[model samples]
Each structure stands twice: as C-alpha cells, then as structure tokens.
Target chain A: MAEERQQGHKWTMIVDLDKCTGCQACVVACHAENNVPSPSEDEIIRGRANHWIRIERYWEGEYPNVKARFLPVFCQQCGNAPCEPVCPVYASYHSVEENLNVQVYNRCVGTRYCGNNCPYRVRIFNFWAPHFDPPLEQQLNPDVTVRGPGVMEKCTFCIQRIRRAREQANVEGRPLEDGEVQPACVQSCPTDALIFGDKWDENSRVAKMIPHERQFKLLEHLGTEPAVYYLKGGETHVGE
Target chain B: MRRLASLSLRQRLILGVAVVGAGALLVALLAIVIAQTSAADEQPLAFSHKTHAQNGIQCQFCHTGVAKGPVAGIPSVEKCMGCHTYIATDSPEIQKLQGYWERQEPIPWKRVNIQPSYVYFNHSSHVAAGVSCGSCHGAVAEMTVAKPVVEMNMGFCLDCHAEQENKDALWDCTVCHR
Candidate 1:
C-alpha cells in the first residue's frame, strides 16, 4: 500500500538565510501550536531542551571581524531518512501522501534508535511527562496531541494545519491553492524568511525560488534529499 | 472411558476445574462483546433519536460540527431549551433539560461513541466523501437512544477505506495518526 502513492503534494519549505534575523519566533510558534512542553533550565543545561526547531548560531572570521550566522534547523523531512530504517517499531516512516517523514507517537516505544540515527539531530525524546500550568492548558490546540512521556517527536511541518487545509479543499471539490498550507514556522516568520508551498505546483513561491543561484540545501553532500531548501546569504555563503 | 479411569482422582479433579474455568472465560468474553455492541449508556436526559428523527430534526441539527470539523459535538442545553421552551415542556426528559438550563449548567451527556486521542478521525472529511452518518454510526434514525451498534476499531475503518477509489492515499499512517 505504501508503494501505491506516486503523485501528491510535495510540501516544501524554502528558508532564505539572508532574510532571517534569528528572532526565534518560529520556535515559540511551534511550541504554542504543537503543545510542546517547555524544558527546564536543568534540561537546557544538560542539552536536553525540547525544541522542535532551533536557530544554530555560528561565528565566522577572527577577533573584531567576526560575523554571526544563524541557520534555523529542524527535521529536513528526508526522502531517504536515516531515522526511518533504524526504528525497530515503524514509528518513523515516510508519508508518501504528503511527501513528509511521519513519527507515529502511538507506535513509538522510546527506542531512541531513530534519534541516534537521525543525521539532522532533529528527533527529540520525551524525557519527562508533559505538563501545562492552569491558563496555558486552556490554550492547548485541540488539533494537535499533547504527547505523553516515552515517545519520540519532531517537527511535522504542522501536519494538523495541512490536514485541515486539505480537508477543506477536498470538501470544496478543488485542489489546494499555492501557499494555502503554512506550517507554524512559515506562518510566524516575521521577515518572510520561511516560504512553504507544494513544490508540485509549478507557480508556487517555493518552485520559483528553487531556480535561484543562492539556493542550496543543508548538508547536500550526504544526499538526504530534504524537502527544505536554503537560500544563501548575500555577503558570504553562510548557509552554503 | 479407559483413559479417564487410568487418571488419579486428583488429576481428574484438576482437569475438570480447568475445563469449567475456560468455559466461564469464553462466556465472559462473549458477554463483553454483546455489551459493547448493544448497550445504550444512560444519558442525563433520555434524548430520543427516534423522536427527533420522526419530528424531522436532522442529525446535523444537534451534531452541528459533524459537517464542519473533527468532532460531532453534543448539543448544548441551550439548543434543547430552544425547542423544549414550547414543545414537550411537561415531559420528564424535557424537564430534566429545563432544570439544567434554568441553573445555567450544561447537561452531562454520556458519550455513546468514542475514539482514542491517537486516532485522529475527522467527521467533516468523512461527511464530505458522500458517506452517510449511518455507515459508521449505525441506524441512529431508527434507534430510540443511540447505541454503538458498530465497533469502530482499526479494522472497521480499514474495511471501508480499502474499498475507496483513493485507497492508496487513505492507507497512509499519517492520514489518521499524526
């Protein structure tokens, strides 16, 4: 049944590194939208912070001539995901319908094998039981699950929103329009750095952006074939 | 008879007990299946589906969210008061609804059908796909109080979904599970 899907939406995201201010708006939006429990100070200190998406800061040049480069990294949604095969349980697998990597929380057994195998280090393990204080509990999105402890979770590109848009389009008896589906990161991007759309649509912003000279992917040499593309910064090839 | 006679009294007694225990377990299992398929959970007010259907009240009139979202939401006491304010005001069931409405409280309606949180079933998509409510929900129009005539396990979903034209897309894990 998995082999049957040959044509469908190839949801893609184009991140222009030049436009990004590294404000962490996407990170905050992801937590709010997905009901991700905030990590403690100790967890952060232990490098166990549960961030679905994070800005990776790098320093270039020496002394006074140093430049700070920010690259927002998350699940690349690899076509040939390393994490997929390593899973004893089929928790991590490619969704042929949406052309995205899916992590089924219910199927996950906390093996952490997927986490270990993931080249992007995007997969996060739930170390403790999830908690939400009073008013914050009221704001939890009914569309997304509040995952329990002992499950693996990563960026889903806000699939709940994708499902919503798809269902709406299906009900209307029409195809999904370009830029109709937006992940939380793309939606909250203040600088419009993150552009998301179905790459299969010839006129989509992502499709148009694909041909640009500045376009590249993170760790392209490894051949993960990620759905995400990165447009290099103007001054220096920081993303490259 | 020869084999039975060869066994000691203690061995025979143990074997007989085991047989009876297994029989009891099988009966218990059958009883559970029967209960799940036919038992109508007692609701706060005996809201009769047959009564409403006969009166030409559409199922979607109360289950407003069925065609719009994931949940087929329970009707609020205010919705009941909208009609019971004039009609059936004296009926005990309607009076129970009136009491809840008078106190500005919601009627605690026990869910007749339930799906786990992991299984992300969307009602709008199913409704849009030309599926009748009775397909999965059974014959609610003919029922007095709605009972789960169908067990909505994974097999129940896959059986119907497999027959669809877009079965390939429907078979994806992320379609129902996030």
Candidate 2:
C-alpha cells in the first residue's frame, strides 16, 4: 500500500498570473511541444481552435475602474476528474504512477462526453486530420503524435518527454534534478510565472506555492481537487 | 474430344492472356529492383570532407544546431561564404556556392543518413555525452559524398550503447522514442 501510494505522485503546476505579461510564450511553447494543430480562421471564430494552454482574458468594471485580468488555463488533471467518470470508454483516467489525467487517443471514439463534462472547456476535438504545411511540419516535435480526425485530444502534460527524462535518470542511476525535466510551457515562460513539479514532494516548488494566500483553483466549488492553481494578480496600477 | 471442342474460343483466349500478364509483371518487378540498386551509386556532387575538416572547420559549422537542438541542420549557403568569401573566391565550388547564395535558394543536399519521423534523436545530448559524430555518421571527415557506411538499425544502436565504456549511455527505448 505504501509503495502504491508513493507511485501515485501528484504532479501539479501553479501559475503566478501577476508575473505573466500575456506574451503568449507558454501558448506557443505548448503548441510546439505537443504538436497541437492550428485550426483555420473559420474554426477559430467558432471557438473550435485547439489550444492546450490558453490565456483567458477577463474584464471587470467600467472605463474609470476598468480592470483586465489574464489567466493561463490548461488541463487541471483533477484528482476526482469529472471527465474521467463521464468517459464511457475509459479513455480519460488518472494514471497510477504520475497522478496525471491520461488521455488515450487510440481509445477515444469522439463521443465528446468528457469534453461536455469539463467545466473549464479545455478539451479539444479534432474535426479534421491535423496537418502542418511542409517545412512547418518538419519543425514538429517527433515525441508527440499528430492526432487524426474523429479523436478527442487534450494535454498530457508532455508525458512522452517526462518519460524520456525519467528513463535517462534511471540509466544514470540518480534521482531527477529539480530543473532537469520541464514541460514546454514551463520552459518557455519568460517571466518564470509557470512552476511545474511533483506536488507530493514536500520540498517541491509546487507544494510550497499551493499554500500561499493568493493561490486558488478555478471552479473549486465542484470539489474536483485540481492539480493546477493560479496566483492572483498584483494591485492595479492607476494614475498617481 | 467432342465436349472439349464445345468450349467457346474466347474463354480459352482469356485464360491464356491472364497467364502471360502475370509472367510479364514478375519480370518487370525484378528489373525495377536491379535498376534501383544501380541508381543508388550515382553521386550528384563529389565534395571532399577530408579537405574541409583538415582546414579546422568543425562538423557543427556545416551541420548547424547539432549541439544545441534536435536537428543537425544542413547549413544554409550563406554559412558557406562566411569563410569562403575571402579564402577561396576563385574556386569553381566556391563560385557555385556564391551563385546559390545570390539566388537565395538553398542547396538541396541529399540526405545520406535519414531516420524515420517517429524516432526522436537529439544531437545535443549525444554530443554532450562525448559520443563522436563518427560513431553513427561513419568518419564523415573522410568521405567525399557522405555515404552512409553504418546501418543505423535498433540492434546497432543498442550494441554501441551496451559497450562497458558507454554503459552510462546504454539502451533506453524512451531515449529515442521521445
């Protein structure tokens, strides 16, 4: 039981929104790393674009007191994931080893039940075979698959790269270093706003960030126990 | 004999034609294989690697990003003129390099060693681990047309990695998979 519990390490991320300049580096990095297809303009207008990590814009109040907030959202990989229970084919389930919500593309029949159940609307469906134009396709990271049509897809937290890093560490007979493994989003963030690590590790950065007063999860009222948390933005700047 | 003679002449002709077509197809397939093997020997350019390497140009100069990224990129024509602009302006090969640069079209260098898209090999990691370029590329500095001498099969990669001297870099499926 102890070994099983140890194996089920919860991986989490805390994005400090205050530090985020809305540069979209994380968005581009995620796309490059995971091979997320860029949808046509028509599809984007219909909100069918597949962005694994998106910077959501929120507006509050009127002209004099107008305040804009940006939040980077992605697959929360919830402990009690709502998407998991709704998956009729068991395509979406939490992995026993990493506590990651693994989405098996081969198994997904595109029923989209999981997408509907997700309150955050992070899951993206491939209406067409995702393709990149010639030279652009060459730039794709071979680690991840380019999903075909009729399959539901979402973030896997770059599990393929993680698996690679872990295997390398094992070969060397040493524990994984702190910054040895970084997802594309975390790696590309210019301001270091996104911090990813093993949440189960008491000394991990994620574990330390989660307890801060400014940290909170989206739709936490539903008891989803999301692995992702956001640090609230700093005080608004006004004409002095 | 009377019953055999009752068979339609057209039906007998059709059977004879089908057998002849099958025979012709088999012969054509063998010829194609022989042609391909012979065609593989043709070289488009007879560039020498030994002379360039001897001039103190590192392998990474022509194969840019080999030490920093996933791809060991074929250097653009502009990169060639960085030194050749002053060193060998009169040479025919240098003139060819300059002409391609003026046109802004890259040289379509033939890939002697190509891996399938599924395999994720990072030159940076391998180079950092002290694996020489010759280990997989087969003494590129000695070749003229960069012919692939080593067959980069899974077994070959495993065997090299399993060497006691290279035990630290030994086989991991994810190393190449991801």
DockQ, all models: 0.56, 0.10
Worst 10 residues of 1 chain A by lDDT: A1-10
List of clashing residue pairs for candidate 2: none
lDDT of 1 at B41: 67
Model 1 spans > 4 angstroms off = A1-5, A234-240, B1-40
DockQ, Cα level, model 2:
0.10
Model 1 earns a TM-score of: 0.88
What is the C-alpha lDDT profile of model 2 across B35-91, one tens digit per residue?
Answer: 654553454434578889988888987888776666788767777778778977888
How much does each candidate deviate at the interface, measured as C-alpha RMSD after superposition?
Answer: 1.0, 7.0
Residue A11, candidate 2: Cα error in Å is: 1.3
How displaced is residue A197 in candidate 1, in Å?
A: 0.7
